[model samples]
Target: MKRRILVVDDQRHMANVIKFNLEKEDFEVILSHDGGDAIKKAFDCCPDLILLDIILPKKDGFQVLKEIRKKTITPVIIVTSQEDEEHKVQGLDLGADDYITKPFGIKELVARVKANLRRLEYLNLPKKSNIIASEDLVIDISKYEVKKDGQVINLTLREFELLKFLALRSEKVFSREQLLEEVWGYEHYGDIRTVDVTIRRLREKVENQSGKYKHILTKRGVGYYFRRI
Candidate 1:
């Protein structure tokens, strides 16, 4: 089955360009020019992936992303013209799987799109041991679900993959670069900050308020590791 992708951009030209390229890669493309309509299409079309622009009429990409995340964990890749780190961080914090700055090469964008979809596909594959539990946290690998203290903890596809990778290794420490290669599945497409953002988000969802149970811990200057306790 050909994967469906929702491309949300205010610029019609840009949207069409992306659509044309993605279609050539055998993806079904759905275009939305504004945030409100994007949100509606996001659910109605049930896209396999989303290429969302930050600037849009009505609600904007962040709002659309927030609304989509409230119910679904679909992979979203922010397509923004802003070069600011703040915007990129905001998108990641709101559950975006990845982001690409504007004027990006069509090849690079295509590569990123394929990479995100690959991760999603890998995540859906069957696992030998479908469950991993430590203390109050339970990771259901087969179902792609995580629970903390019997309550469902919402995690983006990327965040869940990171948690699962580290959890499967228990106390093994991995550098940001190693995680980028292992979890993101790309050595050169993303930076180390992406790992940091994902780890921070994961910790927020699964950790306790008292900071007593730090499931994911930083090793000072090293990197990150999962503490089973």
Candidate 2:
């Protein structure tokens, strides 16, 4: 089946451009001009991925993202004109899969879409070991699920992959650049800051409220690693 994508943008031309480009790639594209409709379409269409614009009519992207996250783990890539680091961090913190600034090349946008979808595809495959357990944390590779203390933990595809890769090689440190290549499937030239953002988000999700991370540990100058139970 051709993958479906929801493109949410108030700008008609922008939305049309994305839709046209994505259709060329053989993806089924759905468009929503407002946040209200975007959230509705997200649940109704059950799209494989979403291209979400930060500024939209009715509710705005962040609100729509929060609503969508409350129900589904569908991958979301924030497309915005904003270039501020704070805005990017906010979107990532709210569970956005990726962030792309406006005036970006169409090919770059398409590449990011493919990359996020590719990760999702990789996550859906069957695995040999299937499950990795360490104390209260459990990672089910087959089901693509993670649980801490028997309670299901909601993780984005990238977050799950990062944790899985490190936990499988517990106590082994990986630099940000290495992690970008290994976990993100990006080259060494990829942004290392992305690794930091992802790590912060992962820590927020998996670590307890007290801020003690038992699973993912920071190596300070180096990078990060999963603790050996």
Q: For every candidate structure, what is the RMSD over all alpha carbons to the true structure, in angstroms?
A: 1.2, 1.7
lDDT of 2 by residue, 3-115 (tens): 99999999999889989999999999999999999999999999999999999889999999999999988989888798778898888888887788888888888888888
RMSD of 1: 1.2
Clashing pairs in 1: none
What is the C-alpha lDDT profile of model 1 across 34-127, one tens digit per residue?
Answer: 9999999999999999999999999999999999999899999999999989999999999999999998999999999999899988877777
lDDT of 2 at 36: 95
- Candidate 2 deviant stretches above 4 angstroms: 188-190
Candidate-wise lDDT, in order: 0.92, 0.87
Tell how far residue 100 is off in model 2, in angstroms: 0.7
Summing lDDT over every window of 10 consecutive residues in candidate 2, give the lowest-scoring window. Answer: 184-193
